[model samples]
Target: MAAPNTSTSDLYRQWAATYDTDGNILQAVDDLQLANLLPSFVQNLRSSRPDGRLRVLDLGCGTGRNTKRLLLAPSSMPLEVTGIDTSEAMLAVALEKFPEATYHCLDPFSRSSPLPNDLRDSFDGLISTLVLEHLPSDVYFSTLVSLLVPGGRALVTNMHPDMGSRTGAGFKLGGDGVRVRGVSFAHGVQETIKAAQNAGLEILEAAREVEVDEEMIQRWKGKGLERTAQRAQKWIGVKVWYGVTVRKIGDRED
Candidate 1:
């Protein structure tokens, strides 16, 4: 259960090589949830701009997992895609895999960071998947709110407090299996909702709570991740990830 106290950027920089290959059960659950969630989200975006003029932003788009999905996802027109992350190493990998999409190495959460404003109110849709735990719980919704255009939709996902408080995102390093834990704050569901309300974002109805199940466990085992399978087996019926759909309505306070 021991993990290093490394910063989020440095940790992901080191883990970028193995990230996509690792049989991460939570991310697998997230993928399953996204399959159901994307249609409605895409419909909402299309409803806003029927002419197919849509732009999307991906926050913490590690190795362009979801970004690639968006690129390949069926669309009326070529959807403009942009992704941002704090780690240049991860972004490098993302850029190589999906060279069409723009990538920025920036962290919006840092108060001293001066570059995020250039992106304000710029996107038609936004996605920040499983990135909230590394950020301050209070500022997440507000920051997300600022980056979107009025009436624009967003999909946000987080590591659920139930599982995160016990053991959040961590990865084994090298042959020693030295675990390097991502910087995390396990925000509870109520607290997360309260923060969204405070940010004045319009919460949409198509939210999701992803739980570990037999299918996820079987996937891990089939992928040669016996350790992960054993861990997820104990978490059956327990929610490990939460996804929320919210909109940037007429702007109020940022």
Candidate 2:
């Protein structure tokens, strides 16, 4: 029998222990994709705010995976960054790595609860990486809409549905590890765009799909991630992830 899937909370709680060290190839690929978009996002965000301070949100900022790089990226505007997550355990790890940033938790069980007033439509930019595949399309984009200022830009990356349909946002357990996936919803690129549009956001840039290739396989092998290298072999020439740059499209009640 296939191992039972772990609950989202349980999966992240346990996964947090080794999340960063696990040599996750998806994160490596995602980091590059998001990194390419950061300069534009930072520059555009700062231009919109006169004080030259960039208020950025790392929505689903897991284990500071992308946050560390964002904090380190060269930016003329000083950044005021905050992170939100559904797992306290994961948040604890993030805090340990990035004590300078503020962190908040939204009850995963009560996702409908609104964020604090100060957070509503408050950010100049947002980054959500490798997270959307695990969420229902509406919930994911709606949450992004809530966190951005009108006209704010966000860079969102996710496991391509082609890939998510095979595997999802999950990791193998600590030992003889059983792979555990959270609730993964298949979301095609058009479906994602449609959901965002419905949530009052518009795609500023079309989806950029990334495929696995031989260089990635060799890179993983060089990193001592033999298992990851082996896995990528099966995915070569496959679209593994996609990203889109978007902006909040309409006026929203803050």
Candidate 3:
């Protein structure tokens, strides 16, 4: 299969219109994986400050599906939260869902482009869900480091290249499908910790899990005989979700 070189911003803008209503919306395999992962991260933050609010940032927040979970109860926070995404359309949906929080439509991943100076290192905690895999290897580390303040915590999750399906598998071309131009890096537990460590972010916890929904599996099987799916289930779990909480330990000057 020929790899497509589609811009993340453009692809998301196209996807935003129907993202929430898609079959893989509420209990989607990927969404469910994230829903399970974030609460643990929140609990870690609460442990640090038992009786105070913690600032948080949700980067590459698409339509706020994963981000919304943080805004809802038991995972709810007693702090200010902000989200940034490259697609305004997706951000619009996020805005509708969580009008109380601020949302920015910008590419925070660009090294040359910084978030508004005031927002720099302004958050106490940060989380990026289903977003890191979209970035190239070097950009991934740079983006994480640039966004953190000293002692701030970050939790980032991405599609597991070794297990979960890559961008644009079942969908048709130019039809709001995922776009991945070959694998720049395999996003797994070790790489996530290593990236944060290289960025001077200390890892507090790291784990990987795969939960395959029988419905999604049947859907794929009906579409075609996906050998990757078959091979993965033989040994590896179907869904690949990873969560890492890290803190910035070094001075910014270094």
Candidate 4:
């Protein structure tokens, strides 16, 4: 996971206030393989624990964009959901939108602080979407397994590193003063699989899919940021979103 840079937090803070109304966030909901991603993850969780209430963790839950959607999804259960993020401004928006669930503003990657001990192994499953790309290699995979119960499951999606090869550049912050050096490193299937194995988690489902935000690309193009626009086009051309579902093992509680 990436270190929490105050700069990044502030930028995200400002973005949080209107993120949901912006073209980018709105596009992600309709663009990302969300139509399928949401339903599938919901069904999987229900299948595994059909009879009980559910505990869920929404990692990097920016302004509750994904959290709001999940909570409102008709397929989801009555959940005791917790959302964690590095941006308080974003968490503020989330808390307002989802008063029913809990929200925490913290850097999951700092390693200085781990998840609350009492909550360890307490969740039935976890869901993190479009948040992994910001994490450095070390924190990205390690923080994931640490948050789950032994038999717990996680669904995560990140910007595919393949974006670099396809468009000459991967994800980057523009006008947003976020310090993310070494943040663009992309994890392939093998690395992700290895990370899960090392963490004693087993892969249940995984794949890369296309996620294109046409309005965002056009917005960049209109702004004459040809480079970013071209890359965005390449992003649409190629499937650059990767996702995976893994279950923690080796803990007998399951």
Q: Give the candidate order by descending lDDT.
A: 1, 2, 4, 3
Model 1 gets an lDDT of: 0.81
Q: List the residue pairs that clash in candidate 3.
A: 210-239
Identify the candidate with maximal lDDT. Answer: 1
Candidate 3 TM-score over all chains jointly? 0.76
Higher-scoring candidate on lDDT, 1 or 4: 1
Q: What is the lDDT of residue 92 in candidate 2?
A: 91
TM-score per candidate, chains pooled: 0.91, 0.91, 0.76, 0.76
Please state the error at residue 153 of candidate 3 in Å: 1.6
Clashes by residue pair, model 4: 1-136, 1-139, 1-140, 2-135, 2-136
How many clashing residue pairs appear in each of the predictions shown?
Answer: 0, 0, 1, 5
Clashes of 1: 0
Off by over 4 Å in 4: 1-7, 25-31, 75-77, 164-182, 211-234, 251-254
Evaluate all candidate structures by whole-model CA lDDT and list the values in order: 0.81, 0.80, 0.64, 0.66
> Candidate 1 has which clashing residue pairs, if any?
none
Error of 3 at 23 (Å): 3.3
Cα lDDT for residue 184, candidate 4: 41
Score candidate 3 by lDDT.
Answer: 0.64
Residue 170 of model 1, lDDT score: 75
